[model samples]
Target: MGIIQDITNIFKTKPKKEQDKAAVDRREKQDALHKAFSDIQQQRLHGIISTLKELSTNEEIKANLKQTRHYKEFEEKVTDIIETYNRKLDHIDPSIKESQKLTVLPIVEAKLKELDKWCEEPTKTDKTLIWKNIGNVIKHSLKAIKNIGNKGYTDEIEKVRYYMKAVKNAKQNTKEAKEEVRGATKTFNS
Candidate 1:
């Protein structure tokens, strides 16, 4: 009877141990998954910041508006956007996984350099010069997006459209102002 009782007790203890081990493994896996998700989210946020910086520094965007009446207005708008985005991004944990930073940093740096060049001299009198430079910047931005292996083409294209509209509006306003001056001169001469 003693031997039989001991055998039953041992069987029960083994199952309880096995159950505890399995529960621990499950918890560990859950924690790992959560960590991975958090890391991915951070990377995406960084990508957003990189894209915004590229748009801010794009030379063609700057050149189109530089001499326009709305130049300051547009600059203020863009600056605000960048500041707001940066503030939000800064709230993210600063600790980034090493592998991710290695892959993301260089592409972001290159994009930023291109943007800085654009901002330095936003526009010149040469129509073709401004558009051509802008086209090149857009191409470079697209390439960076590709290198990052993300899907932001639509957003990027929208950014191009925004600048294009600004250029077009500036040109129209300049034309209207010239016409107004011409009318005033004709009246004065009469």
Candidate 2:
């Protein structure tokens, strides 16, 4: 009966990591959307500048506009949009630089370096010891990383580490799958 129960547990459906997947998906989508919007805004500003340049180039149009009452209003409106977009562009660069700097994760980097140094020599005696070693690594990681924002959820370091762990597992699985596929391809071609 215990053996049957253990077998059932082994085949049991695990809970989905909904938060982790949603966060990664949301961040990627938001970044792509912001880039697209920035591109569109840049194009619109360039189009406005081109229009203003054309207005300045034509003698008749310039003379007529200078004589008209609406010319000052038109000039002000166009100039305002140009200045507004200029200000927007100016503000964007510094913020981007700041955010890029914030993604450093200093403590995380240190811990990763430590792991690299430790992993340089194989010290595991058995399978259980290897699993315990891995758990300790994760425990230290959770403690080392205090916090990381930018995942759209300003969650704890533990949560962020969970996301990274999930990604690492996925990447490992993908690499193994590719290797298997390549091996199979060679066999089939032969």
Candidate 3:
């Protein structure tokens, strides 16, 4: 019986300690990876926010943001996060993977969607032109009104008169060109 008991003990020896140690090692690796990924995510998020702030005020920076390469960098960073989490999940259970996906995917999708929308807007130059043309007209009108009080309205009136004369000349030239074309067409058809 004693010999049998010794044989049984040898055969039934527990592997719980080794299993626990392996679990600890796996957890340590996962924690380190998560920490590293968190750091990278922090840096990337900071960079993107800073870039966005600059872009909001700087036309050149805004143009850069519209570039495909910049968005591609953002995509790569998002993909990195997804891949990192997937690798970490390989060491974890199924339940945790679902939770991680729930937390991460939506945030990534929303950010990308915002960037895409911003890219679809008109370029800074077009916006600037629209504002400049409208603003100039408003400024000129205000100046003309102010000149009426100063009795210096003659200069503004002359400017308008010159502008009108230029318009009339352009219209006259266009009419002449159309008449010449019509005469040439009639001659050719005849």
The candidate that achieves the highest lDDT relative to the unseen native structure: 1
TM-score-better candidate, 1 vs 2: 1
Q: Give all candidates' CA lDDT scores.
A: 0.55, 0.46, 0.46
What TM-score number comes out for model 3? 0.34
lDDT of 2: 0.46
Query: Can you tell me which runs of candidate 1 are displaced by over 4 Å?
Result: 1-14, 67-71, 89-190
> Model 3: how far is 14 from its true place, Å?
6.9
Give the range where candidate 3 is weakest over 10 consecutive residues by summed lDDT.
129-138
Candidate 1 weakest lDDT stretch, 10 residues: 97-106
* Candidate 3 Cα outliers beyond 4 Å, as residue runs: 1-14, 58-105, 108-112, 124-190
Clashing residue pairs, backbone N/CA/C < 3 A, model 1: 59-118, 63-122, 63-123
Q: RMSDs, each prediction?
A: 12.1, 30.8, 24.4
lDDT of 1 by residue, 1-190 (tens): 9999999998767687788999999999997876775565446546546545554576755655475554574356446545655554455455754334344444444545555454434444334334444444445444444444345644664565555455445545566889999999999999
